[model samples]
Target chain A: MKYTGAQLVVRLLEQQGITTVAGIPGGAALPLYDALAERGSIRHVLARHEQGAGFIAQGMARASGKAAVCIASSGPGATNLVTAIADAKLDSIPLVCITGQVPLSMIGTDAFQEVDTYGISIPVTKHNYLVRNVADLLQVIPEAFRLAESGRPGPVWIDIPKDVQMASIEIDALPEPGRPDTAPCVDMDELRRAAELINAAKTPVLYLGGGIVTAGASAQAVMLAEQAGLPTTMTLMALGTMQSDHPLSLGMLGMHGARFTNYILEESDLLIVLGARFDDRAIGKAEQFCPKAAIVHVDIDAAELGKIKRPHVGIHGDVSQVLDRLLPLIQVQLRKQWLSRVSDLRSRHPLLMPGLENPRSHYGLIDAVASALDPLQADDAIITTDVGQHQMWVAQAYPFSRPRQWLTSGGLGTMGFGMPAALGAAIAEPDRTVICFSGDGSFMMNIQELATMADENANVKIILMNNQSLGMVHQQQDMFYKRRLFAVDYQRRSDFVKIAQGFGIEACDLDTAENPRAMLADALNRRGPCLIHCSIDIEAKVLPIVPPGASNTEMIGG
Target chain B: MNMRDSNINRKLNPEQSGKAVLELTVRNHPGVMSHVCGLFARRAFNVEGILCMPVGDGAQSRIWLLVREDERLPQMMSQAGKLEDVLSVARHGADHRVFEKLEEFFG
Candidate 1:
């Protein structure tokens, strides 16, 4: 059978079970888009911007735990994808990004709409391929998918020339997709040794991270924590690994993490780290983080084991597999003294819940939103957020019950990630409700995506925490920079509700309503896509911030 | 190879700067190097030299990474060996002479 390279691209995506692709078209990508139009198997989402397309793909991948595809034209279009690709890499999201290039004949003649897509994307992607020949598409396309979703999943790039996309190729049969390499087998001896350490330690803590979600080891993680009777503290990325309200859960630990959580870690004799790289944000000071703990690091990526905190026992395998073997070997013990000590610490430095009962305070907006969306909790509800003080507030206020439900740009901390990612999540799970919690500054960064949301009729409820400034930076400047604010505050407040209305989305100003909770509920309930603009005090801060380079034990505020 | 063999290999040469060679046995697959390198890059850990080639039955490859000897090296060694494709990691002194040979060849 003879097929054009463009058609083959669509066919390959279909074979990989890809039903939707988010992208925009350009001169170089016209052939591919034309082919896609001819074949109706894969639905294409037309994003307002190339970055939105890239993030939409990230959202879908993050939501579904599958390799999602994004496309772009050459030059500026491809460069626009660089941020999202980098975001995916940092978060370990599996995405395959395809970009169209100029025809082979134009090669290095500085062709119009042509950029070295491979060169630009190299640092950002897990792997990249520049398909010089049409025939190589058969191998490259499948390999791109395999590499993207395989071990330590990340974005992969494929730059296909326009001529290659237009050229027809005859193939007897497509090559079989390659099997992903299996993780290195877990050593039973190491597992037993880890178990021995856990069994012996009077104070043990389970340090969980995003790897638990990536490995689908949340169940195993919960089981290991319960069986070992260990106190658990998760990084921001591992929020929903253990239910927020779980007794063992110490909430998030690090920079903005609860003071008690860090205290427990500091006091622990053993830290059973699963699938979490000891990131700088999570570990206030490398030498001081869990200083008393003998680390037993279990991760799929071997390189993470000794990268920051050297483990006494390094178990390199799938988190689930390692946990499965290690769980039975652990002898459950009642550390009444340790438990009481942790409880005492928790009571001493409890996570400040500002608006749990009353939602009218300056910091009560996050709590109000959480309360308003409680009904959606029983359904498939997802919360995506951009970076700022609001992001931390949502992380603190929301009780995330399961993995993949709380999607935020944790590692990369990209400012404009929420709106497009929420759109992507809504696109991936149409039946679910996606609430994007964005600060005024963050919302403005990718505000163009409001049009895309309206166009798709996405079921997204955006809760805009409008503080009228870059909240986190403003707070930092206030606390450390002697209150000298520069470029952090907006001189005039933009009417977010008016902007939402202009984008064809239902908009409401919660500050104007007599009953803010009722207003929030109304917006959340009656939404194909709606934005609730909640006014917040600029002085409101995400409390209990561990000052940079300070130990987690040393926090400035609550 | 075992620790003794690696130690003997290190002992053969006397050029011992404050560098260590981490020999990794990894599955021969695309992106394995990226995974290994990315880990270092993320932590801002600098790798001085790297050498990789496929070994036995073409199913696996051996990678030699030369990095400065620091407190983090022990942890880095464990981390590199924890990669999905990595089968084993053996550390040698900077005197391993693998990069020296490559430098000689290129020079």
Candidate 2:
């Protein structure tokens, strides 16, 4: 059979089971786009910006645990996807980003819309390819998908020249993409040694990270924790690995983590780390963190095992496999005294939130919204958040029940992530309600996505926590910089409701409503996209903050 | 050398700043190096030296990373071995001459 490279690209996408591709087409990509139009099986989403396209793919990938595709023309279009690519790299999202390049004849001639797509994407992508030959498209596309979704998944790029897309090639059969190489077998001896350490320990804390969710080992992690009666604390990326209300769940532990969680970590004798790299944000002053504990680290990524804190027993395997092997080798014992002491500490220093009964207060408003959403009770609703105070507030107040249910930009802390990610999540799971929690500062970064939401008729309920300032930075300045507020305030407040309405989405102001809860409920009940602009005090802070370079135990303002 | 003897050798070395060689057998793939390097880069761990070459009909590659000896080396060895394409990782003493040979050639 004879097929053009463009046709083969579409065929390969179909072969990979890609249903939708988010992108913007240009001259360099016209052949590919034209081929896509002719094929018409894959739905093409026209994003307002390439970055939004990239993030939309990320949201889909994160939600579905599958490789998601995004496309863009070369140069600025490709450049716009850089941040999202980097975000996927930091957070390990599987994305296949295809960019159309200038014709091969104009190579390095500074041709129109030509940039080194391969060069720019190398640092941020797991692997990248420049398909100069039409026949290579067959191999490259499949390889891109394989690399994107394989072990420790991240973004992969394939840059196709316009000429190649128009070039015809004859093929009888497409080669099968190579399967991901299997992980090394777990050493039973190491598992036994780890079991011995766990059996001998009096106080053991299971510290979880994003790897558990990535590897689909959440069930195994939970089983290990419950079977051993170990209290657990998770990093930001690992939230919802254990239900928030689980008795042994200590919630997020790190910079803004609960004081009691930090105290418990400080007191534990054995630290069983799962799929988590002890990031600086999670482990403050590494030398001082879990000072008394002998660590046992298990992770799929070999690099994460001893990158920060050295573990006594470091087993390199999938979290699920390692736990499955270790679970039966160890004798389970109850740690009543340790659990009681942890409970006492938690009671003494519970996560303090401003009363939700007082809806006028900023924290109160957050509490009210979270409660109205039934965040604690329902695991179906997905919440995506932007960075800053609102992010921490959501982390502290929202009751998350499962992994991937609570989506936020934890590693990159990228602003403008909420709305687009919500769009992606909504697209991934149409039956589920998707909520976007954004502060005023973060919202404006990618506010153009409102048009995308309206265009897609995406069912995303956005809660804009409007403080008219960069609340997180402002709080830090107040505490550390002697109140020299520089570049932190948004002096003029934009009417977000009007802005949202302008984009053809229903919008409301929560601050002005006499019955705020009823108004919010009414907006949420709408079948289409909507936004609730919440005016909050700029002075309100995310409490229990550990100042930069401070030990976790030295947190203040809870 | 057997895995048990190697474990004993690692335990005998206590100098945290001494140099160590990690030799990895990995499937030959474009992204394999990126995955290996990205892991170290994410943790801000530096690789003092690197040597990679394909082995046995280009199906697999052997990568030798020279790094400072720290308590984390054992764990890092375990981690490198867990990468999808990685078949095994063997640690060597600083006296291993791979990097030295490369230095001599470069010099």
Name the best candidate (by TM-score). Answer: 1
lDDT of 1: 0.85
Ten-residue region with minimum lDDT total, candidate 1 chain A: A354-363
Q: Model 1 over residues A416-473: C-alpha lDDT tens digits?
A: 9999999999999988889998889988888998999999999999888888999899
Query: Which residue window of length 10 is worst by lDDT in model 2 chain A?
Result: A369-378
| DockQ for the candidates, in order | 0.17, 0.15
- On a 0 to 1 DockQ scale, where is model 2? 0.15
Which residue pairs clash within candidate 1?
A: A302-B79, A302-B82, A302-B83, A303-B79, A303-B80, A306-B75
RMSD of 1: 4.8
Give TM-score, chain B, model 1. 0.79
For B1-106, candidate 2 gives per-residue lDDT tens digits of 1223344666787554588898999888666787788667765678989889999899999999999876556666765665556788898999999998888777
